[model samples]
Every structure is written in structure tokens, then in C-alpha cells.
Target: MLVSRQTTVHPVAAPPLQVELADAPPPGVWMNSPQGSAGTIGGVGLRLLQALSAAASIAVMASTGVFPSFSAFSYLIAAASLQCLWSLAPAFVYIYALLVKRSLLNLRAMFIFSVGDWITGTLTLSAACASAGVTIVIDNDRKICAGNLCARFMTAIGMAFISWFALAPSFLFNFVLVVTTFASLLAP
Candidate 1:
């Protein structure tokens, strides 16, 4: 009689859980909805508006050699320049998403957009208000307002305000997206 050896086999366990980093909200969430598409479209449009307004403000402000005389105008030009660049980044991203992804679901990107929008919004608003105040003061002086330069200042301020207005919705949308995405990430 021959002795037989016993054999044992162990089944493989499931792989370790992994987390995926998204640049936007969860796919099944709002980012894929009709409302989400509309929001994305609106955001893209706003970015374009922001860029144009900022560029216009810069051009008008720089057109006058006296722009450097007013600190507020300088700040306005700087802020508008920054806003132009900031808006361009998101604008390109949104355009890419529209063409390829059909939706913007990047949580990280939206968060960034929110922060940038707020920053640019605040800067643009303050710059506009400050420049408007200075322009008003200049207008009151009569002598300072002798030239049409004050008109350019008013135009620049108006454009800055428009840029700020456009930034509002974009910021709001991204803020909601970031909050919801974070909440979703925390869910069990």
C-alpha cells in the first residue's frame, strides 16, 4: 500500500481598493445632466466674456500715458491682465471638454476655476470701484477732466464691472460643483 499526500489551495482575494482622482464632479452626477451641460456652456461663455472685457480694460487703460499716474488704474490693468490669463485657461479647458468629454466633470479643475474666479472677481471689482472713484474725483476737478482721458477711464471701469459680473456665475457654478464633489467623495 502507498501513502498519499494532502494538497491545499487558497483562493485569491479581491484587489485592494483604489481611489480615482477626478478633475470634476462624479460622472453620474450633475456634470452629465442637461443642467450641467447648460452650466458648462454658460461657464465657457463667461470665460470668453471675462477675457474680452479684461483685454478691453487693459487696452483702454494703457492707451493713455497717464495711466501710471493713478495707482488704481495700474491695479486695474494688472488685475485685468491676470483675469485675461486666468479666464483663458478655463476657457480652453471648457472648450476641450465640450469637444471631447461632452461634459466638464473634473472636480479638481472646477475647484481651481472657483478659486480663480473669486480671486479675479474680487480684484476686478475693487479695481473698478477704486478707478471709478478716482475718475469721479478727476471729473470734479474740471481741469483734470479737460481731456477725454476720463472717458477712457470710465469705459475701462465699466468693462471691469462687466468682467466681474460674468465671473459671478462661473464662480457660483464651480463652487457648487466642488462642494458636491467633495460630499460625494466622503460618502460611504
Candidate 2:
């Protein structure tokens, strides 16, 4: 008689590195990328507005030659560079969506995202104005008044409206989506 041995087989799992890489797919669809949607386009555009605002502020500061730094030009560049980070937020959001494997973003979620953009945009715009005010003060424009507060407030509100405008199309898109989603859910 011959003795027979039993054999067992186990499935091998992917290596950790491979799994990690598989989880991190590059997003190719426009839905996740800034170029795919209007909201992101607006984000990039508004970021340009902020950068220009920052640059204008730096220019004013530089023209005055009032900064007490050894290399005033360097400081101006530094200040402008700091504001340039806004240009990257849209790309960052796109990457974040990619990391989550998000292909089709929900409209309501887009609306919520717009709200976030609005908050950030308004805050940034307000800060830009305040920075301009600070620069004015630094340049010895001591004609300070309660009017400046009103001016800043108005500027922020105006900028907030622009942010709202940026969100408007996306907001409508989201509303349609939300209604459609609900309708689909309710359909027999």
C-alpha cells in the first residue's frame, strides 16, 4: 500500500507597497480634476485675483522703500510667494478626490464644497483688503477714519458676492443633481 499526503493551497495577498500604489490611482476624469468642472475653474480664477491683489500690495510696499529689511526686494518676493499657494488649492482638491477614488462627485457635495470655497475666498479677500490697509498705514497715510472699516466691510461683502457668483453655476448644478437624486430615489 502507498501512503498519500494531503496538500493545501493558500491565496497570496498583494504586497503592502503594491496595495498602497493600487489605492492611489491617478485621476484621469474631469469630474475629479479642476478642468472637469466649473467650480474648480472659478477657484483657479479667484486664486489669480488673490495673487494679483497680493502682488499689488507688495508693489505698493516696494515703491515706498519703507520696509526695514536688509533685502527689501527679497521680502517683497517672499510676501508674494506666500500668497501664491492659493494657486495650488484646486490642484490639491483634485488630488484629494483622486485619492478617494471619486469619479462622479455628487451635486450636493459640490454645493457644500462651494460653500467652503466661498468661506475661504471671502476670508482671503477680507485679509487682502486689511493687508492693503496695513500697507497704507505703513506708508504714512494717516488719514484713518471709520470709513475704512466700512470700506473693508464692503469690500469683503463684495468679494463674498463674487465667491457666491463663482459658486452659483455649481450651486445650480448641484441643485439639479439633488432634485434628480431625490426624484430617482422616489421613482417606482
Candidate 3:
């Protein structure tokens, strides 16, 4: 005799697994964070302004056709050109950071940025001041500025000043970041 066994299969239902993903940091939080200002929108804007003003200064001075005669004007052109290139490099990096929604301000980067800003800011200020002094002297003398040369020189000086003004904030911000970073490292 053969015996047949019948078996019934039962299905068990398991609870669904829930996964929690971390949300991205908000703009205000990251923008104001001490990580570094170089990656922020405002930082990028300031850099662009500096670059544009510096380039404008170079262009205006070049158009004057008399900058080659004055050592001060030549110095201004060099400084402005340097400032433009420097500002542009950081602006590009900041723009990339913004696109990826990331901050580009590590400790090393902050220190480097601080140093660069200081050097460029000093050079820009010196160039602007020197050019301004020369321009004033030329303006005061009727023989030197008989044409529109003085006016063009004045405009270039103004642009250089604007570039330096924009650089000032960036320098201060980067300096603060470096100081805070070092302080935190040395803290108990």
C-alpha cells in the first residue's frame, strides 16, 4: 500500500525596511560656517567684482596711450593684471563648488587663500595709491594733463581702488578663517 502526503505552504509577510537619508545643509548654515568663505556665493561675487574691476583698470590704462611713459602707471597695469588673474582663479573654483553644492574651504585651502589675499591686497593697494599720487600731480600741472590723459589715469586709478576694496573683505574673511582654525586646533 502507498500513502500520499499532502502539504500546504504558508506565506509570511515581513515589514518593509525604512531607510533615512541625511538632508543637505541649508544655504544659510553653510554660507556662514567657519569652514571658509571662498566657497560661498558672496565670496564668488566679491571675487568676480575684483576681477572685473582689475581688468577694467588695465583696459582703461592701456587705452590712455601714456601709461608706458610713467613707471607708476606701468606698475599699476602689472598689479591690476595680477589681481585679475588671481581673482579669476578663485572665482572659478568657487563657482564649481557652488555648482556641486559643496564647500571648498579646508584648513589648508583657507591658509593658502588667506596668504594669497594678503599679498594681492597689499600689491593692489600700493599700486592704486602710487598711481593716484602720480595722477594728482599730473592733474595739478597744466602742462602734463593738457589733453584727456589725466582723466583716463584718474579713471584707471578709480577702478584699481574698487578692485582693492573688493579684495579687502575677502582678505579679512580668509584671515578670520585661518585664525579661527588655528585657535580651534590649539584649544583644550
Candidate 4:
């Protein structure tokens, strides 16, 4: 008897599975920060005030021919000149940030600003105080106001004080920005 053997076949196994994932979120802009827009605008305003006051001080001091005789007055002019330059850059930066509605108060920028503010503020205050002291001596103790020189000197000192006042606030504001930047970096 011839018996036909039954044919057995097994089906092929399925292919291995694969899973697809979504892309990650995009990174934020470098200028963007947690600091508000008002802070930037205020900073610009403060810097502008600083520049203007320092310029005024320089103008008033330089206008008088006798100012060259006094080293303190000359120091005031030099300090105010340097201060104008230092404050102008930050003013422009702040204006740009305000126009873009972003914050430029990053760690590096703020640190630079803080150091600049400290240096300029100290110089400005010292120059103003020295000039004021000299003016007081000439006006009160020495009684050397033959003409209107004393008046002009007093005006210059006043302007220097105003510039210093404006710069002090800007310096404080920079520190606040630094703190904010530090906090942001430490955040999860």
C-alpha cells in the first residue's frame, strides 16, 4: 500500500515593531529673559539722564576760562566725559531691547554694566564732591568770587551731583538684573 505523507507548513513570523517619537521644543532667543519690558525702558531713560547731566556739567565747567586753574574742576570735566561715553552704550542697548520688546540683561552684559556703573559712579561722586568742596572754600572761606566764576562752578557741581544720582540708580538696577539672571540660570 502506497500512503501519501501529509505536507505540513508553518506560517512566517511577523516583522519586528518600531515606535516613532515627536520632536522637542525649540530654544528661546538669546535676548529674551524674565525681566520685563518696563525695566529696559527705565534703564534707557536713566542712562539718557546720566549722559545729559554729565554733558551739562562738562559744558558749564569748560565754559569758564578759570576752570583750568583748578585741578578739581578739571577732574570733574574728565570724569563727566568718561561717564558720558560709559552711559551712552547702555542707553543704546536698552533702547534696542525696548524696541524689540526683549531683555538684554544677561549674565555677561549685566556684569559688565555693574562694573562700569561702580567705577563711573565712584569717579562721578568723587569729582562732584571734590569740586563742591573747593567751591565752598572759595565762596565761603577764601571769598574769591570777584566775578561770576563761583556761580558757574557751583552750577557745574550741581550737574555732576545730578549725574551721580542718576548713575547710582542704574547701578542698583544692574544688580537687580544680575540677581534675576542668576535665578533663571539656577531654575530647573
Query: If candidate 2 were superposed on the true structure by all CA atoms, what would the RMSD be?
Result: 12.6
Ranking of models by lDDT? 3, 4, 1, 2
TM-score of 2: 0.34
Model 3, residue 55: displacement in angstroms? 0.4
Winner on lDDT between 1 and 2 is 1
Clashes of each: 7, 0, 0, 0
My TM-score estimates for the predictions, one after another, are 0.78, 0.34, 0.83, 0.76
Query: How accurate locally, in lDDT, is each candidate?
Result: 0.81, 0.46, 0.86, 0.83
The residue-by-residue lDDT of candidate 2 on 1-188, one tens digit each, is 99987698788987677344543434533323334343344444554555455455445444444333324334433544454444345445655654555544555565554555445445444554454455456334765334344344334334433433443444354455556655766999
What is candidate 4's lDDT per residue for 1-188, written digit by digit as tens? Answer: 99998798888999888664333223443433333222366677788899999999999999887888889999999999999999898888888766765556458888889889999999999999999999999999999887888999999999999999998878887777777768888999
* Greater-lDDT candidate between 3 and 4: 3
Of models 2 and 4, which has the larger lDDT? 4
lDDT string, candidate 3, 28-105, tens digits? 333355322788888988999999999999999999988998899999999999999999999998889889877665
In candidate 2, which residue pairs clash? none
The TM-score of candidate 3 is: 0.83
